[model samples]
Target: MSDRAVPATPPPLFDTAVVAGVGLIGGSVALGLRQRFLARRVVGLDASMDVLREAEALGVVDEVRISPGEWLREADLVVLAAPMRALEPLARELAPFLNPAALVTDVGSVKSGIAAEMERLGVRHFVPGHPMAGSERGGVVHARAALLENAVWVLTPTDHTPLTALSRARTLVEHLGAAPVVMPPAAHDDLVATISHLPYLASLALTHMVARDERLSLLAAGGFRDLTRVASGDPRMSRDMIVENKEALRCALERFRRQLERLEADLDEPEELLAAAYEGKRTRDSLPVVKRSLLPQKHDLVVAVPDRPNQIGAVTQALGAEGVNIKDIEVLAIREEGGALRLGLESPEEVQRAAGILTGAGFEVRGRS
Candidate 1:
């Protein structure tokens, strides 16, 4: 054995990141890399000049490229945040432009299709990633800086994927303050099929079921609204996810059908079924709560304040004067008197600073734990 101590190599710094689709996920990722990693430059490529312009105005990227094929040659990291159907074609188009050593990844919810395409294209550095963070709303307009914060970002690396590329991808995810979990591609598909794809179909079905009965719309309340909320998501994107993950989704649907059948068979005794459902709720509630610290941590401050115009602006302005960055803000509640607002800060010290500034400014501030 050699006596010399081998020095650890420094993390690879991406010279430039190219996001192929400047929609919500792509725009958000570009913004995150620029803000968190201090990336030298970030370029966005989109077919829509309007979206490209919007992305530039939003500071999601340093520059926008009208043509994706031309910019792919220079990117150190190429992220495909396009729809599932576009991935195969995009990979084929990008293969020749990509540097042999550069890393390639996609934010597609389905991995098997993309991975198979990458294999066919002979792309050695490709890694399949899915960030489990999104809202029912779509497009760059709704893209948030803290969208990926504390979210479970899964990486499904195939046997052919290069280890160095996988490490770099994980580093990129960590830099964005996301929790990274690794699993086999098939397993990842199966898991997401159950958790994500199934819910989407169920939501759509629930929405359709209600739409058939015009009178049901008036009867719809909190539970109906909450359960079918995701049905409001982009129809195109939902269609893509369902088609791309068809096999896994089919299996999941079968399981769900069996459960529904059992419930239908037990429906004669409505009270017993209702009691069983309550027991199910109790079992779910009995599960231990996931500790906050166990998840990725971020600095945040919550404040209880009167519901009035300009109060938020005042609080934010005070913090801005202190040079503190506000990642996100949520107006939690509002009554005739007051409401609670939660502000996500960039650091714990900044949260304290914001609390002090708001409190001194005569607003009731709550320091979040």
Candidate 2:
């Protein structure tokens, strides 16, 4: 969150930060808040007692409470990291309790519905966010501070959203090592419906179709595994995401259906379908390697290093000297000799400079994306 080095001590931005859920996204945000010193006091609210117990034990939150009252009122920043279904009602409860100057944000996938609810509740300082980061696995145990590293965290702010709320949410996104992209609520829903929501449904259909075939286990390979990977994620979360943004998803599904129809019509002319496939490939490949961003998008590079005590710091210091800020550093596959470590930086140029710095310092720099 500072200029370069992971601060030994960081100035807190919020007097109190409250996370309304203790699952993957919520827990990860809580972990980031602590790791980055983004908040002076961190608290969590979850209906699940088991989740609260796990989150507290994991030290993601300083305190955990089942219901909101004083805790909600004390928070300067409140993140509704609960399911999409939970946000509407939760906003209703917090409508009366929130600090007048507090900023409210959410990790819900869809924003239009949330925007509508906030409007209905007269919630002034609300920002809707969706961090395009997470794994197939869910829950607090799997939450990691680096889960958001180099990932996209979108802020969907309508004209009604206060500038202060938007700015605060963006700062939190960057502090967590994620790039923040700003857009309208409807535009975000329409965009993700094609890229995110559609993939989930497609993966679900493919996964189900394969499951019904007894021989699928034998035939399945990397391609099948890759295709159905989205389907393996938490079912309840996927269902909530799908149901919440049904309108945009409906349009996306219809478009996909039309594409299928075109391919079906081309069955008699195999070459036509092949041409269509090639065109699709070209369009997909043309998409920017870096997703669109409001800030300079963070880039990642892997460094192969000797398992020396200060090897990682050596790399960080090298970059720090160049004014290249390392957002995150992850050590991977440590062995007796050396290991691969990933460095996340604020831009593509920083990634290159950091990689060069590490390489010159006698560490092997590999993967960059």
Candidate 3:
């Protein structure tokens, strides 16, 4: 018996899907495609035979190859999950073997350059994409199909891109449990620079500044640790991302600098600093919650959980036993021996039921305000 959970009705299946560069992002995409039954076969391509072997052993791909070849002829879908700079070169090599109608996409963070490169190479049916999801850890061993769940997968399709191609990419995103968002390539690049790239840089800067003083770094607690956590991610990958999108990132940096300058100039005025902090808190809180496709907006319930070996597992198991489906979850805060978990449920009734269930289980539960 296969361990794979094949859906009763799979989405439009690709005859064969090719994923180049089987690292964290590539491995995750391959797993997602196979687990969702969106591809009849998932083939991994990487320059490293060692990486390919790991991917195959991990069941991230049905087959693995060190390079692109005639196998591309059978591929109806191709995902370039390599670094931003390598995407064009890899695409060039695979273009000839790919079927004329094959739909191609990428997980490259920066889309504008690749979009232009694909067009320059005359590669039709190419849709530049980026999934706003990943982990600090890298490698195939760390890849999980759940990594992309409820993620915002951005598809930056040019006007010249065929509707059929864009539709197919969206279908793949949906089947992978991601929400597809359409935007221009340049616009996508600019937006990610501010939200994604800028944050990484900020984390990197903060971590380096504090680490310069060992005693000071040793004293770093909750907020400081959380703020600098991203600095622990793959430095090579982070370097490539910020460099590839430097122009937009520079603009974002300048905007941030101005904000800092204003705050610094008003350091003597405590009220001004407090007001600015309040403004930031309000803006951050007002950011719209992510709603997965094909599902109603989720209602949130906050549960205060005591720190214990299996507190989270116990809560999940208890909810599972009651057939309560948690659409999403987040660890809101942690202090000393306890923390709060926010659970997202389908309906208000489910929220109420979940609150009562947890409360009955001796947990302090509260509905979102």
Extract clashing residue pairs from model 3: none
| Residue 153 CA displacement from its true place in model 3, Å | 0.6
What global local distance difference test value does model 1 have? 0.77
lDDT of 3 by residue, 1-369 (tens): 875322122232587999999988899899877655557789999999999988988889989999888878888999999876788799889887888889999999999888998898888899999998888888988887667878899999998999999998997887677889999998999999999899999998888888788887678888898888878888888898899999999999999899889999879899999999999999999997765333233487656666565677767877899999988877643444455566779889999898788877777665532
Q: lDDT for model 2, please.
A: 0.80
For residues 1-369, could you state the per-residue lDDT of candidate 2 as single tens digits? 644332122246677999998899999899777655567778999999999999988788889999888658889999999877788898888788888789899998998999888877887889989998878888889886668766888999989998988998887787667889999999999999999999999999887887899688788888989888998888888899999889999999999999889889999888998898899899989975643223322477766555456666777878889888878766543444445566777778877777777766666564321
Candidate 2 colliding pairs, count: 0
What does candidate 1 score on TM?
Answer: 0.74
State the lDDT at 341 in candidate 3: 62
Better of 1 and 3 by TM-score: 3
| lDDT value, residue 206 of candidate 2 | 89
TM-score of each: 0.74, 0.75, 0.75
What candidate 3 gets wrong by more than 4 Å, as runs, is 1-12, 288-369
Off by over 4 Å in 2: 1-8, 286-369
